[model samples]
Target chain A: MRTWTWLHKWSSLVCTLFMLLLCLTGLPLIFHHEIGELLGTEAHAPEMAADAPRVSLDRVMEVARARHPGKGGMFASQERDDDRVWYVTLSDTPTSETDLKQVAVDARSGEILTEPQLDNGFMYIMFSLHVNLFAGLPGMLFLGFMGLLLLVSLVSGAVLYAPFMRKLEFGSVRRERSPRVKWLDLHNLLGIVTLVWFFVVGFTGVLNTGADLLVQHWQNNQLAQMVAPYRGQPPLTRLGSLEAAVSAARAARPDMAVSFVAFPGTSFSSPHHYGIFMHGDSALTSRLLVPVLVDATTAQVTDTRELPWYFSALLISRPLHFGDYGGRPMQIIWALLDVLTIIVLVSGLYLWLRKHRAGAAKEAA
Target chain B: MSARRPLPHHGGRAHRHGRAHRHRPLWRWPVRLGVVTLVGLLSALLADGFWDVVSWLALGALVAVCVFFGWLRRG
Candidate 1:
C-alpha cells in the first residue's frame, strides 16, 4: 500500500500538468472539422451532377502546381468525408517536411478552391500544443514519456483505491466531511470512472508519438524491398501521367479506393515510384492503408502489399485516440469525458498540495 | 453451557467475516465499469449505426454515474 501510494504521488505529480494540457487541447480537436466549417476555412466543392465528367488527376496536379511555381509535390489526398476536393501538398523538395503549402482543387471542374492555411490558426495552435508543444519530434517524444508516467500513475492510483474505498461504498462522496475528504472521494470516483478511457487514449497517444519513427522504419524495410528493382535508376526528369498512375493502382486493387498518392522522392515513396495508397470502405479497414508502388515513368504497378502488423496497429490507434469514429454524439461524449478527466487531474493536484501543506505545518508546530 | 458459550462468539465472528468478505471485492464495480468502457471504445471503431449507438450509451453511462454522485445525490 505504501509503495503504491508513493508511486501514484510521484508519477501523477510528474505528468499531471502535461496531461492537463493534452486534455484541454484534445477537447477542441475532437470537433476539428465542425470548427473548421464554422470558421469558413474548410473548403467545399460546388455541387455537380452525379454523373458529371470528372477532371483527370493530371489536370488537378497541374492546377495545384500552377499555384506554387517551383515547389515539388509531396502528397495529393482527399478528405475522408469530402472526396470532391483534392488537397495537393507541396514543399521545397519532395521529401522536405517543413515550409509546405496545400492547395485544394475541385475534383470535377479542376478549379482552385482555396489554399488552406497549415499554420497560425486556432486549431493549428491547439494541434501543435496537443501533439508536440511546437518543438516537433523531441516535444512529441517527451509527451510520450509523460503518457507512460500517466499509465504508471493510473495503475498505482487504482491500487490505492482499494485501501481508500474499503470502508465507503462505491460513488460515496461524503460531502458533509472536510473539503479534502470530499475532493478525495470525488477524485477517486471520477478517476476510476475515467480510468479505462484515459488508459486507452494515453496508450494510443503514446503509440501515435512514434509515427515518424514507424514510417521511417517502414520506408527502410517494406518500401525499400518493394522498389528494389529500380534502386539505382536515376530520377525521372518527366514523371508519367498522374491519371495513368492512379488508374493502374485502381486496376490493381479493384475493390479499394485510392486514399492518397505519395509522389516520387517523398518520405512515403521511393525515388522512382508513386506510392498510391488504397483503402477499404469499411470503418475499420479504412484506417488500414495498402500501399501500391507504381513505376513513376511507365505508370505500371510494380508492387502491392498490406502494411505490417506494427503499421496497422499504429493506423488503428489514430481513431481511438482522436474519437472521430462516430458522429457528433460521439464527439460530444468525448468532450464531456475530457472535461471529467480535467476535473480528476485538478482534484488530484489539490489533494497532493493540501497534504503537503498539512505535513509542513505539523512539522513546524 | 460451555459448548453453547462458543456458539454466540462463533456466530459473531462469522457475521463479521461475512461483512469483510463483501468488502473484499473492492474491484467489483471498477472492473464492471471498465469492461463496459472497453466495449464502448471498440464497438464504434468496428462498425457504424447500431454499434455506434451502443458505444454512446455505454460511455454515457459513466458520465451519468459521475453526475448523479458528484452533484445530484448530495449529503
Candidate 2:
C-alpha cells in the first residue's frame, strides 16, 4: 500500500504538467478537421457534374510538379469519401519529410484549387508541441517516456482506489467536508471513471511516438528483401504511368482501394518501385494498409504484402489515440474526456501543493 | 493533560482491508465488464457504416456516467 501510494504520487506529480499540456492541445486537435474547415483554411474543389470525366492521374502529377518547381512528387492521394479532389504532396526530395508542400487539384479538370502552406500557423504550432515539442525524434521519445509514466500513475491510482474508497460509495463526493477532501474524492472518482480510456489512449500514444523507429525497422528488414530484385539497377529518372500502377495495385487487392501512391526513392518505396498503399473501406480495417510495390519503369505489380501484426497494432493505435474515428460526435466524447483529464491533473497538482505547504509548516514549527 | 494511548497504525490498514474485501469481490465483475464495454465502445467509434452500432451503445453508457456524476455534483 505504501509503495503504491508513493508510486502514484511521484508518477502523477511528474507527468501531471505534461499530461495537462497534451490534454489541452489534444482537445483542439480532436476537432482539427472541422476547425480547419471553419477557418476557411481547408480547400474545396469546384463542383463538377456527377458523371464528369476525371483527369488522368498523370495530369494531376504534372500540375503538382509544375506548381512546385524543383520539388519531387512524394504522395498523391484522393479522399476516401470525396472523389472530386486529389491531394498531391511534394518535397525537396522524395524522402523529405520537412520542407514539403501540398496542392489540392480538381480531379475533373486538373485545375489547381489551393496550396495550403502547412509549415506555419497556429494549428501547426499546437501540432508540433503535441507531437514532438518541435525537437523532432528526441522530443517524441521523451514524450513517449512521459506517457509510460502516465500509465504507471494510472495503474497505481487504480490500485489505491479501493483502499481510498473503502469508507465511501463509488461516486461519493463529500461536499460537506474540507476543500482538500472534496477535491480528493472528485479526483479519485474521475480518475477511476476514465481509467480504461486513459490507459488505451496513453498506451496507443506511446506506440505512435515510436512510429518512425518501427517504420525504419521494417524498411531495414522485410522491405529490403521484397525490393531486392531492383538491387544494382539504376534508379528510374522518369516514372511510368501511375494509372497503370494504380490499376495493378487494385488488381492485386481487388477488395481494397488506393489510399496514396508513394513515389520511388521515398522511405515508403524502393528505388525502382511505386509503393501504392491500399486501404479497406470500413473504419476499422482502413487503418490496416497493404503496400503493393509496382515497378516504376514497367508499371507491373512486383509484390503486394499485408503489413505485419505490429503494423496493424500501430495502425489501430493511430485512430485510438486521436479519437477521430467515430466522426464528430466521437471527437466530442474524446474532448469531454480530455477536459475531465485536465480537471484530474489540476486537482492532483493542487493536492500536492497543499501537502507540500503543510509539510513545510510542520517543519517550521 | 490526560495520558494518551498509543493507537496502533495497523488497525486502520486492517479495517480498510476488510472493507475492500467485502465489497471488492461484489463489484469486481461489474467493473471488469464495464471496462470491457468501454473499450469495445471506443473501438466501435473507429468503425463506420454497419459497425457504428457499437460506438453508439458505448457512447450512451459514457454519457450516462457523465450524467450520474453531474447529478452527484448538483447534490
Candidate whose TM-score is highest: 1
A311: Cα error in model 2, Å: 0.8
**lDDT tens readout by residue for model 2, B31-75:** 864675565565564656555556655654654564476344555
Give the worst 10-residue stretch by lDDT in candidate 2 chain A. A162-171
**Every model's DockQ, to 2 decimals?**
0.35, 0.23
What tens-digit string does per-residue lDDT give for candidate 2 at A1-365? 78888999999988888898898888888988787888777778776678999888899889988998999889988776677888899999887878899999888999998886678887888898898999999999999999999999999888778677766766778887899988888888777777787788898999999999998988887788889988999767788998788888889899997788899998889989999988898776776789899999898999888788877789878877887677666778778777877888898899889989999999999
Per-candidate iRMSD: 8.5, 7.0
- Give TM per candidate: 0.94, 0.91
Tell me the spans in candidate 1 whose CA falls farther than 4 Å from its real position: B1-25
Off by more than 4 A, model 2: A49-51, B1-21, B25-33, B36-47, B50-53, B70-75
User: What TM-score is obtained by chain A of candidate 2?
Assistant: 0.97
Scanning candidate 1 chain A in windows of ten residues, the lowest lDDT window is: A159-168
The TM-score of the first chain in every model comes to 0.98, 0.97
Q: Give the CAPRI class of candidate 1.
A: acceptable
lDDT of each: 0.90, 0.81
Clashing pairs in 2: none
lDDT of 1 by residue, A62-176 (tens): 9998999998789999766667899999888987867899999999999998888898899999999999999999999999999999999999988778778877898999888
